[model samples]
Target: MKSIDVLLAVLANGWVVSAVLWKDSISRNTTDILRKRYRDEKTQKFSTVFNSRKPSLTSNPASKPFYITLPLDHFTTSNTDTFQSRYYVQDSYYQPGGPVIFHDIGESSIERYAPGLVDEEEFTVSMAKRFNGLLILFEHRFYGESAPLTEVSRALGDASKEGLTAFFKYLTIEQALEDVVVFANNFTYDFQSYPSQKLTPEYTPWVYVGVSYSGARGAWLAKRNPGLFKATLASSAPVELKVDFWEYFVAIEANLAASGNTNCSADLAAAAAWLSQAWETQNETLVDKLIDTVYQADWENYISQFRNQDDPRIWDTRRDYMQDAAWTAFADFQYYGVQGGTLGKFCDIMETAYSDNAPAEGLFATESLDRAVAGYTKAVAAINPYSYSRSARNKAKLKQKRQSSKLDSSLDDYAWLWQVCSEFGAFQVANTSRPQNMLPSFINVAAQIDQCIGTFGESDQVSLAGPNVSPINQKYLGWNIELSNTLWTNGEFDPWRALSIDSTTEDAPTNDTSTTEIPQCGTTFPRGTQLRYVIVDGYHGSEFSEDVVENADDIGLNPTNTIGGISASRRVTLTSTGTGTPVADARNAQSLWFNAMSTWLPCGTQVFTFTSPQPSSSTPFKTRSSYSTDGPSTDGSTTEGLTTDGSTTSNPSRQSSSPSENKTQSAASLVLPPLMNLFMLSLFAFLTGVGFIL
Candidate 1:
């Protein structure tokens, strides 16, 4: 599934990159599940057939890109510097007085496929149409053409430290969020081609929607600037920022075992143990054997060339680099979960594709670890998971990435890395704390910091102490936060779930509502009441890929592609009215999302009315068939905590009334309607799709 997804992405990108481009494809950005998973590095060769099929960004003039000048620093008066930040408007479904639904293209270039995201059938686009609102996709600062300092190279070893610092100094979540508000304050659009639903918070209502990191921003924005946004729908928002973040492996290990990709978790664990032993003990003979077995490269010759060329191992040169390379198959799980688990493809090979040298059976003088290594070696050789080979182009590109000092994205990476080095201390280190860990024990936060310091001028300053995630968490209130008029969702099997409200590995514990904790979050939501949901078997941002449910077979989804051979995509096709199917559960959740929004959104009339609809304490699945609401009212404030605020309660227990649904109103299940054609065309554009391949 990983390779196929990669192939589709590569095909969608319309350019066959030199084989080495995959190195650039693996992003070590803040949101590991979104960026490297869906979109990757760009090239102009290797693949030309698919390029012809890609839709042009100009195909829809209504969604054509737009830009506005934004101050480099909104929090400080340090400089009056400004940059042109790019945005796109898909107002086909918008009315003159409708609300504007802003989608933050968080940390990626919207210039790719974002400008073409005008299709009425898109999940976000569909929401805009449903609410008669304008859909705006705003690119985050320091990404795409939104960079404040363009000509300034952002390379880690930037020639001018001032240039590197100056370029990234202004990029903070606070500043980016401010950019949205600032843009809205003086917002104007001349859609001679289309009527602008242009108005500020004083006269118009605004809504925020995003997935992954952008989703976190939605939650934060709703909390900080309600005057600017009335409602927020955050999907897979990892509000908690932890430096260790070993729970990442916890979720991955748990999910792999649960979904019937049997032996995958255990096999990888054994492999990690052996890899750690061989690398750390300086077992040269074993290292050579493993390298020859896994990568099929001549270890001695490769080493000679590596020394001569001074190539940068994409992850790090310190430990066995393949330790990082081993999991590329699984990193894109969220990206492929809509189709099926990305691990599904890799596991099939792991379970079946044995290389010639792989042992036919357990042999004498060998422990079980030997068989595990053989299996892994065979799997890696068969999968060619990294797209890395000892070709001249591959080695050359590796050297090129290291020697190049431009931070402005020769491959467009350093921007996100800056954020990771800034406030998002989500270092995906090995969980040595756990009794059973899946990653090589050698990978630690210190190594990460060393690289950051070695590359950029400074680390997050955490050395061995790990990053002080408190800076972002304390400010945002982490999972301790509660927002009225906001909806939160997560994928049950997503590795990122470890970082979300559904987390259970200690850092922060939740006394859930299904059991009776008061406000149910993450696990369950009451109809017409609570706004949190955990999609059973769902992956990161799976909500946006709703179209996959309708076209499962058309796109070659097999029934056995998911857990225990249960096609995950098939679960989305189960009737949309019940909790039995993954799709059904998600749609039903979205139904509540609609019901809540209908009552919350005061565009014109009361669509569905609801009372102070408090969900039962804990993760209880209570259902209410009917609801009623009074029309939305305005306090008439022009700034912070705007009119039509739907936030009903906070954790500290703020008293705000919520609406009730007259009936269980479900959002219309999505239909592709030629949308996939456009979706694939712009598939290369969701720049930051999943998280780090590292």
Candidate 2:
């Protein structure tokens, strides 16, 4: 009865039962599971759009580039109130690959990247090729093609009855970041939807790299959207979260000392003293001459008067040297050397008062000496407001006026003296001013100087303005803190707006251990988060040495490929490893040091090192690394194998047969015994089934 019922059910539902049973068997099959897993693995391997494409080289690639323009603080109702932002992209060379994009972050001044200065297009191309990605360059919100929105709004009376005050408050750093993100999203989507030349199939990962001011923006974007950018590189950045004027003044002072200007220091002091005294005497003619001198002093004359004072023949030598184009070039090179960070020897040459080996040239020529005296006299006279006051001649009134004028003059002299000292590096500027003032000034000046010097010369300068300019601290408070953090926290080589003061006392600890102690008055110390500091003994922005560049290659970075390679003579190292043979088994440690040094060694002579457990008789291995050339010492080794080469040390306990032995065994196992047995079993089962069927 049961067999008859089963047969009837199978005959009626054969197709349905077969379909359901087959589907269930397929779902449970190992082959099917393996196939699904393989597909998932493939997808994961190509997850990043950037890695999806194949490498190719083409002189004239057939692809049209797409561009996006963003408006920051654009006023809808007024033409004057609009600011511009721009970004560019190109499709990937590989099909179904991600697109590449580049962004150019603008610096602070309106005159930045002008016709005579650094070529923007060249810079863009170099950076694009260096990163092996698409490029995007945009003017800052208030500069260049971008409009000064606040100024424009005020001019157009965009604000309500609240007047210009309300309209003037339109620009801020956060708004700048928002503008960048918006432009990026819109541009990336547009490229993905309708590529310029159909080279790239979809949007790809983005990378942002910036120098000086724009470095601040790149850092801001990276920190704000870590997931967005695969990586970010910022150079010569000043990333102080808060503004402090005194901090900047302090930096200037430090720069002055760094300049290696011996005569300038003493001269500046004397000039200040002279002005203060003259102000008390109400000297008018001297004040006017001093102002005129500031405008007329050429680079050579200035250097001679300040740094090369002891050399009686220095001015003549410079004049003679400048007569020949080759000599002029040599002088320019020397000047750049001083500016770059080669101040020790340069200062020695100029230190006539301290050294017996003085050059024949006097610090200043006769004409220059005359000019300086006149300028000093003029500056002194200008301090006296009463010098211009001819009507009040009463004895008592005259005395009171003279005293007041003297005090004002003295203050002005002090200010100018501090500026000169900071400019030439007589003392650390941070030690001269209060931190509140120091911070903002440091941020503004440091940012400006780095941008200008990095691209142009100290001779070329630019101006910045806004209603919020004064009390710079208040104005900078509006800047994005994220940008600040990104700038300061990344590399010690990079400078931020934070005030950095030198220790006044020799006994003062190097580390910032006094967490709760507020810096003293007139000290330009940084507050808030303590910065990780590394002092490199070389010129600012000097190229790293070839050896350092070679070392960098070990760490997977080629600084030469990125920045025109370093000069062969420059010595740059990450550690304090002096030139010598190892005292013990330091070979591996040295190799590790070489790898670690490459990561952050700027284009110059550099050495790097790491700290590890010293080798002992019991351990017999000193697992450490260290190196140094022309810069500060660094640590780049870890306990878990060497992080430099992306490899781990083998465990001492684990032992395995060599590849040859394993291969011999694997080859022998490729015999027919297992196959023969399986075949015989299958054949017997098949015969038994046949017999049953018969």
lDDT of 2 by residue, 1-694 (tens): 4543443233222221111112111111111100000112232110001111122333212122122344434323233333333222332322233324343444322121222112212323323333344554444453322433233222221122233223223334444555666555555333443455322212344445454345555665655554344334443334332211222233333544555443434333334344333433444355434433322233233333344344433322222111111111111111122232222222333334333653233233212544545533332222111111111111112222333111111111111121211121111112112321221111122322232222112220111110111112122321323221121211122122232111222222344421212122123235432212122321111111101122332333342221111223332334422211111111122222222222222221111111222221211122212111122111111122221233443110101100001111011121111111222232222111110100
TM-scores, one per candidate: 0.67, 0.39
In model 2, state the lDDT of residue 284. 35
| lDDT by candidate, in order shown | 0.49, 0.27
Question: Per-prediction RMSD in angstroms?
Answer: 16.3, 35.4
- Evaluated against the true structure, the overall lDDT of model 1 is 0.49
